[model samples]
Target: MSWFEYRNQVLCAESVSLAHIAKEVGTPLYCYSTAALKANYEEFVDAFRDRDVLIAYSVKANANQAVIATLSACGAGADVVSGGELQRALAVGVPGSRIVFSGVGKTSEEMSAGVAAQVHQFNLESKTQLESLSEIASKQKVEARVAFRVNPDVDAMTHEKIATGRRTDKFGVPIGEARSLYELARSLPGIEVVGVDLHIGSQLTDLEPFKKAFSRLAELVNALREDGHDIRHIDLGGGLGVRYRDEQPPTVSSYAELVDETLGSLGCQLILEPGRALVADAGILLSRVIETKQSSERVFVIIDAAMNDFLRPALYDAWHPIDPVSEPQPDANRDIVDVVGQVCESGDV
Candidate 1:
């Protein structure tokens, strides 16, 4: 259900006025809707209720402790990329057994920390990392549950920085060599090979890439099972995009339908690592209009929020819907204002 509604011609978040939040928390503050977050989580859970799925909330989306704690209280797991995220997840009562770690360059300290925390699984990206993890596990005398992230080499049809599963990207092991890697992990002394994982890319809007990736992953899973390796989990790492601009994204129900159909009757457990889809629309950064500067060709609305506060716009040239809380009448006058932030760099928000 839609939470925000115009009250007296001003948009509010869950009966809490956005203007009030901006004033209370101060400008450049991030306001999150606990209801929205909970609703998004419940939406996905309900859609995939029949499947053996674990919704690992990706912590990188918005790592606020309150947000993490809220999701944890709702029986959601975490998909962490670094030791910091792992610690944050555990700090908020998200059990280590429910955490899946994914990143390309994991340091020795990070591995030791994750091993200490007893994370559920590690989405291994490279052969070198697999060996390192095995060594760390051997030294710690703990069995490391691992899933080799296979790069299906499918184009996710997203921006370059976010596209991960493409052949030119360095995110995962090539699909052709995934089985061999699984065998190698099985033969390793300290590693316990559990499953296969993949993250094609972020902000993915279409289903062809997902379908192709899942089919390829299913083939490898079957082959591995036939060849005497025990693969039990399939992590289709979340890259489902949202309607940040004017584009429309598949609702959580439709997205789950695609996934459910793709892995029909597969014996392995399904794990979805959703981050942006759950939190993006639930939270928004509010900044006060610091000043209005006029230019020869345009006008700029300099706000207090900077790259430090919300970097998506600057980092990815991402589009975030902006609206003035107390705006003048629409028919009064119109001017194209470039809403910007206070960072001291060209790439700053």
Candidate 2:
């Protein structure tokens, strides 16, 4: 199913050769497979076909217009965090009703823009944000459909920087305090409590964390219904991990089954925001090897690409597979060298 494969001893993005692309567009460029993008988006659609689900592609992962438009053509909505992201989604003809504005620090201006666009839901992280949106929407004379992103406090068992559901993280309000906030939201003007939202962390490979969070959310939904709130949506923010190396992420079908098992009885529209899972494997960073040098201790392979160009390795110590554009012979001698960027920083590896 990989679109990037070797054909006739040349690595290709779909049917186009990478060498041809590099020769034409030059190195240090990004190439995305339109077919791969469509296939990834369709996987979600096929998984949740039987349910009332919205697979909102998280725009922050890969905001390329071509990627967004490809997904949009596949009937994918957008999950945007900032005003610029909202505009980007809108620019691709993604309707306001299909956009979910989600972020921890949404400014007043950003909230106003989201309100003006009439985004489907605003995943409010704090009570002050709830109040701000209420005031803005009240002045604008429109009911802003809102969801409270409650912190489930479950460890996603991923990278610490990406793990967000822990109580100490600054993302969502505590779960115990969500009901009281929902009550406050109902009392406030121009705020319509439509759903509940929670995003535990990114690059999550296991389902236990999700099961724990969704179970708690289900309990809250039952409690919220008892308290006389018309909750119609459940925004389970994205954190599904994709395989960068040896990661066996749960299948989309399995994820959908988990959702059904946890919240199917609630009869609410399910919203999933998946960013990296959709585009991570759909694109590749094509760079040329500038030089190879030997040091007293080790050898290094330098490339024209820098840490600023591709930051995962520099930022998260992330690993990505490196391959030569030309297919090497099976018996070709391999040199163990540290592949690094040309950035002036030591962390450029």
Best by TM-score: 2
Tens digits of per-residue lDDT for model 1, 272-313:
999988898887777788899998987888888888877777
> Against the correct fold, how does model 2 do in TM-score?
0.99
Tens-digit per-residue lDDT, 1-349, candidate 2: 8999999999999999999999999989999999999888889989999889888999999899889989998889999989899999999899989999999999999999999999999999998999999999999999999999999999999998899999999999999999999999999999999999999999999999999999999999999999999999999999999998899999988999999999999999999999998999999999999999999999999999989989989889999999899999999998889988987899999
The lDDT of each candidate is 0.86, 0.94
TM-score of each: 0.95, 0.99
What shift in Å separates residue 175 of candidate 1 from its native position after superposition? 0.9
Sum up the clashes in candidate 1: 0
